[model samples]
Target: MIILQANQLSKAYGAETILSSIKMEIKHRDRVAVVGRNGAGKSTLLKMIAGELPHDGGELIIPNAVSVGYLPQQAVLSSDKSIWDEMLDEFSDLLAIEQRIRLLETKMGSEETLSNEASYNKIMKEYDTLRADFEARNGYQLEADIRGILSGLQFNGFDYYHTTVSSLSGGQKTRLALGKLLLTKPDLLILDEPTNHLDIDTLTWLEGYLQGYPGALLLVSHDRYFLDKIVNQVYEISRTHSQRFSGNYSYYQEQKALQYERDLKEFEKQQSEKHKLEDFVQRNIARASTTKRAQSRQKQLERRDWMDRPDGLEKSVAFTFPTDQVSGHDVLRVRDVTLQYDDQKEPLFPSSSFHIDRGERTALVGPNGVGKTTLLHMLRGQMPPSTGSFQLGSNITLGFYDQEQAQLRSTKTVLQELWDRYPSFDEKDIRTVLGNFLFSGDDCLKIVNTLSGGEKARLALAILMLKKANVLLLDEPTNHLDIDAKEVLEAALSHFSGTILFVSHDRYFMNQIATKVLELLPSGLTTYLGDYDYYLRKKEEEKERLALDALEQPKTDQEDGAQNESKESFEQQKDAKRKKRQQERRMAEIEELMQQTENEINALETALLQPETYEDHEKAHDVQLALQQANQTLEDLLVEWDECSTDNA
Candidate 1:
């Protein structure tokens, strides 16, 4: 069924029209991803469909009795209610039905001449129907279902009973709202950037849940991976128009390119034909004998359906920064670092040691709250380490770009902002830089407050370019950028010879730009000489080994009892002279081994990057073999250490 349909939909804010002549049909069971760059009317479309906003010029037809649930980009929940009560409210309809059924059951059991046969029969019939409906909808297991959904979304072991909505963090509130929407089981689900704050595990669960959802889904998200995993179709709002793609995001990209090529070819053919017809008509129009032919040609020209030329990324700014002076050999150095926020109880990364060589592109990776941003702040000199010290080499200036660009002035226009930041830059230079970043003539007049997330990111990046710093520290630099803008940034980073230390969750972006990956774990920070994908594979191997060892550990009563005694003894003698000597020797050997492997891996990477070596089959094969061995050895060592620790425990 056509669950939702829009015709001639147009929305305007003041004189600026965000959407014009938007038409779309949302069918039942269709999973559509509404995609566009930031500030591309995606949220506005959802609001219109949800009846939260009126369309200025459009006809909207929604089927009667069809329910629609909308989860906006930002959602607020009632503060007085606990998480448990918030979810329970989704089933208000079911609760009402249950009340009626209960009342009927009570009457059926009463006296009044054995309940009058006909009335009793009617009551029983209604009860049976309601019961079946309830069962079909999984009503009886509503609490369990709600609990499962919440748990899957990483609310496991949480005290939802006491945790009120207002007490929950922003991410928690969003999850709570998501749980409610799932329980409501509406005919249409509209979600905006639902995966913005979700962790990998939670996102995976959401993908599975949405896959089995029986209703239509309209989701707007910048998470390409999530959209590709969940959505079957893509609705792209572009350049004052909306285009539909018949397949997943990856397929849409492929098809879009193919369609563009086909259109260009067709247009070329039509233009060629038109030119020939025009030539024939112009030459024969004055000849009496050929007047009929000229008239026929003119008619053909008037009747022809000329093809419109394909336009590419509309008004996309082309930006590139001038290179800066070379930095010292040692760009940044940290020794035995230990950082702790005043408000945080735990240290971010203690006993951490790292060195950033000039022109090395590194990606800092970890789960949320694992100190990715904290580490960046420490590097930028905005925050000091609790213990130890860090140094920036002489002549190595830093360009720091926080997710929330702190330097932006809300009251300043784009030009004024640029000028204020870089007084040395002439107007021509400023315009050129802005143009490269996609900010054009009148766009330069836009106030900071009016700019979208992508625009802000772009503007911040432009400012970074003007600084001409030899070292750049970025935290979630791609957080607010669309795919196109991300591509632009990636291109800039790829060409940039300066040292870069970035924290980003975008795996694709990391793969393209990261020359090395640093993983921050509870134990310490470990640097791997490769991109994010390489690190992921090694991490997975280590995880699987740990899981396998955990499964195979001795758990019998006799084994447990023996281990308990041994553990006690071991702890008691942990500080003894002999034990301390043994521990130090083993630790020294492990450290030495890690360093040796790192050296070997670095050599192999250097060779792999060489054009001549990569082209040679034998040399490339050798490099690959050496890299695999080094990575495998590192993973094996980690697993072995984990296993020994578990056994000792």
Candidate 2:
């Protein structure tokens, strides 16, 4: 059945129509991935479908009884509620039903012998029905299920009962909202950029959960791996239109290229035929012998229509940095670099020693708070190391892209920002450079605050590329870019002849760009001589080595420090084993529930299939309740299975 259908949907803001004549349909369990550049009206369309915003010139048809839950780009939670209370909202209706049944039972037991025979019979029947409904729903175990979801989403170690919603940060609030939405179990789930602030482990957990989701889902994200894992359908939203591709992300990319090639060939053929027909008509129009034939061909030519070309095609920018001078062989050197923040006892980077060579591209990787950004700051000479010496090669010019984009002035217009950065450039030169980065006529007039995150990042990058630097230091450069823009940057970096050091969590981006990898563990840096993929392989080998070492080595006084060093490794193994046992127990329970629920569902389906079952309304209602309970219970069980598997992995 169609869950949602929108026809000729259009949305306008002020005088501009952001989405015009849009149409799409979502089916019961279709996992649709939405892709588009920033400000292309993707979010506008999602908001319209979710009923959070209204459309100006269209209608959205949602089939009756179909439920939808939408998670916005930012989640808002009430300050007064605790995380536990907020999650409990998802099961409020079921809890209310159980409460009502409990109260009825108490009243029945307290005072009352029914005065009338019919009243007593009605009371007994109602009580029996409610008990069966409650049991079938598995209403008792809802709290346990919710707790598991919270833990999987990275809320572990926090007391859910005591943590109030107001105490959480933006990312934490968004994660909490996601957990609640998952527990709500709507027929359709809509998430926009859900992985924005998630850690790698949290993202992996979510991917597994979504891959096995039974309900329909639609999401907008630039994380390729996440989309490829969860979504089956890809919807490409261009500036003027949208098209559906019939597979995952990789498949869509290949199929889309083939489609464009085919269309280009067809277009060429039609143009050739139109030209030939025009020539024949012009040559023979005046001659009596061929006048009739020419007229017939003219009609055919008039009836011919050309296919419209696809929009949103950006011509590849063909330019590279002009290197006026080469850096020395030793691009950079850091010795005994111990760093610490004010009021923080732990040094972010302790006694780190490393060197960079000319034209080398290195990636700095660690968890969020593990000094990747701090290290970049130190390298750029922005911050002083606590105790150590650092040196730069002669004739080395540094170009930096920090998270703040410090070069941009917030109050300036887009054109003003570029003009101020390049004061020596002529008016024409500034425009030419800005045009390459998609800044045009009125767009350039917009203030910096008006631009989206991706646009701002692009503008910042465009300015950075103009600087002729031999050494580049970029921190989280690809944070807000779309897939297409990311590819553009990747291509540019591949051709760049400068020494590059950047921090990035995007595995694909790192693999394409980095020639070496630097892992910032608690113990300074462990260097690897290859890209991200190679680092992953080496990491697995290291883990195996540690597992073997655990079996071979024994404890000693001198080895106490070494044992302390291996604490992270030991903790991970312990967690892995604990998760494995938890998964086994949960999987067994879920399997039992799944079988029981399936049996109940089949029994009700059989009853519904029979003509006589509909005659008694009470029996029919009872069976319907049973079917609904079975479905909810099965959904809960499937979610549990996903969480267990994620924990184990």
Candidate 3:
């Protein structure tokens, strides 16, 4: 059922129209995403839909009984009650029903009620109905769900009953707010930038939970990976308008590029025809013989409806890393480096040892509070490690992008901010760099302290670009960047000849940027010599392997003669080589199947891009659905491959 719909919806701030003639709809189980560049009115639209803000025009329809839960970008909870009590408030109806069932049970056992046959039967019937309702609403699992959601949000060890929401940090409060919303299970779940503070593990869990969620989801996020996994439809708001696309983020990107090309070509076609008509009218209007024909052509031209030029990416940077002076083969080297505060009983994390070669992008990932940023600070000489040391290669200039935008809080004007960093750059050159980042004449005069997060991020990037560093250590570089900016940044980093070692929570960005992954555990660091997807497969395989080993407990030593019996049996199995041979054959089969599935997927994607396929909406959808199935097949094949590879190794 259609739970929400908007037609020509609009909003304005006095004379400035923030959104115009917007159209949107959400069905009962739709997984929809609203995306656009920063300040494109995405949040404004969400606010209107969530009923926090009223629209200036047009219709916003929501069914009377359909509940809507909105979690804005900066969601927070503040209450005097403990966190657990606040969460329990979400299930008060179920709790009430449970209480009624218990009261009925007590009444049925009393001697007075049982004495009247008809009343007793009525009481028993009521009890049965209430019990069914309680079970159907999952009254028994309410506490379990509260615990699970809180734990998933990283509040596992906290005293949920004693820790009041008023005592938590802003980020912690936001997490708790999300957990409470999950428990409520409203008909429509609207989340804006929900993945902002989630770690990799929590993100994975949320994705699984939402995939099976019974209610509809309306999300706005810059995390493309999260969008790709959760959203089935995309609505992009641009230039005070909205356009709907049918697919995940990746598919939307693919289709958007093709659409841009199609638009450009159509405009060029019209321009060519328009020029020919104008030329004929100008040259022949003076001659009586062809004057009538020319006049007719002019009328036709005047009557033609002109298509507006396709506007896209209004501000874009011409960005590249020019590696004039190359670094040594090894960009960085760390040995047994660890960090611990004086008051801590143990180290912040285990000793870490890793190396980055020139031109490699390494992703540093861990759970929240695992000290990923602290480690980067130590490597950059901003802090000292408690143990061991790290070194940067010769001739390397290190550039850092701090996620907090700490350097941008100064009162300096935008122009002065860049000028302060590169005093060598002439005024015109400084202005040019700032312009590329969308800081214009008056914009350049705006104080840095007043810039929005996106503006600050842009300024920070402009500084990074001009630094000319051969090695980059970025901490959450994409934090406040819009999707457009992140794409441009990804493209720049992907082609950089320099080396990169960065920490990020964006899975899509990690996959796009990292050639290797450094997993930082509390005890130690582990390295994966592949991309994020590869690392995930191996990680799962390691768990499976440990489980298998645990199930096979080694036989204890028996009498002296029989002590080595189990070892002798394993030796006999090795001599047979049957299991080893079977594993090898199975591994080969998995590899072959993987290749075949990938080929099928690629073929489907190619077909999706073909005019004969894409121009026909029905055909394109069929091919896209097939492509999704094929990709799922490939993932399954990878899991099997991991199982075989781990055992064989």
| Best candidate (score: lDDT) | 3
Per-residue lDDT tens digits for candidate 1, residues 95-132, read 88888888888888989525599888888899899988
- What TM-score do all the candidates reach, one by one? 0.77, 0.78, 0.83
Error of 2 at 242 (Å): 1.1
TM-score of candidate 1 against the unseen true structure: 0.77
Q: Model 3 reaches what TM-score against the true structure?
A: 0.83
Model 2: residue 388 alpha-carbon error in angstroms: 4.3
RMSD of each: 16.2, 11.3, 8.7
Clashes of 2: 0
lDDT of 2 at 630: 84
Candidate 3, residue 323: Cα displacement in angstroms equals 4.7
Q: Which pairs clash inside model 1? A: 317-438, 318-436, 319-436
lDDT of 1 at 248: 69
Candidate 3 or 2, higher TM-score: 3
